[model samples]
Target: MQYRWGSAWGGQRLLGTENIEVAIINRGRPLRSVVLEIRGRSPNGLPPVRMFQEIEELPRNREVRFELASYEMPDEIEELNLSIVSSTAVE
Candidate 1:
C-alpha cells in the first residue's frame, strides 16, 4: 500500500483542522482486510500523533480516498509516516 496527504481540491494543504485526506493505492495482491497506520511528528518535540484506519477490502491497482478524523493533530507536522500494520490477502 502507498499513501499521500493532500487536500481534495489541490496542493499539499491539509484537509481541515479535524480531518485528514489521504489517497491510498494498492499495488500488490488483492486484500481481504488491511490496517493502515499513520504517524504525524512535529518539530516542537511533542509526542507523535497516531491514527489508524481499517480497510475492509482493497483490489489490486485500485485507489481509495479516505478522510480520517483527527482530533489531536499538531498544527505544524514536520513529518508523516504511513505504514501497513497488518493485512490479509484474498485467497
Candidate 2:
C-alpha cells in the first residue's frame, strides 16, 4: 500500500483543501474486504485526526486506487500513518 497527498479542487477555483490518494496492490491472494485507518496530525498541534475506509472484493495481483476525505489544506499535516484495520480473504 502507498499513500500520496494532493490538493483537491471542486472546479476552476481551488477548494482550499487537501485529500489523500491510496494505492493498494494485492499480491498474496484475493480479498473479500479491507478496512484501512488513516491517522495524521494538524499543524496547530492539536490532537490527531483519524479516518477509516473500507474496500471490498479486491482481486489478487490487482492495483486499486482510493480517494480519502478532503481536509483543510493549511492543516500542515506532518506525517500520515496508514494501517490495515481488518481484512477478509476470499474463499
Which candidate number maximizes lDDT? 1
How does model 1 fare in lDDT?
A: 0.76
lDDT string, candidate 2, 1-91, tens digits: 4444443333322442556555667776787778888787766787786878788866787777777656433355666687878888887
lDDT (CA) for every model shown? Answer: 0.76, 0.66
- The runs of at least 3 residues in candidate 1 whose Cα sits more than 4 Å from the true structure, single-residue gaps closed, are 14-18
Which segments of model 2 are wrong by more than 4 Å? 1-16, 72-74
* Weakest lDDT window of 10 consecutive positions for candidate 2: 7-16
- lDDT by residue (tens digit), candidate 1, 1-91: 7878765455665634545678888898998688888888877788888888888988899888877555557665667788889989887
* Backbone clash numbers for all candidates listed: 0, 0
With a 3 Å backbone cut-off (N, CA, C), the pairs that clash in candidate 1 are: none
By TM-score, the best candidate is 1
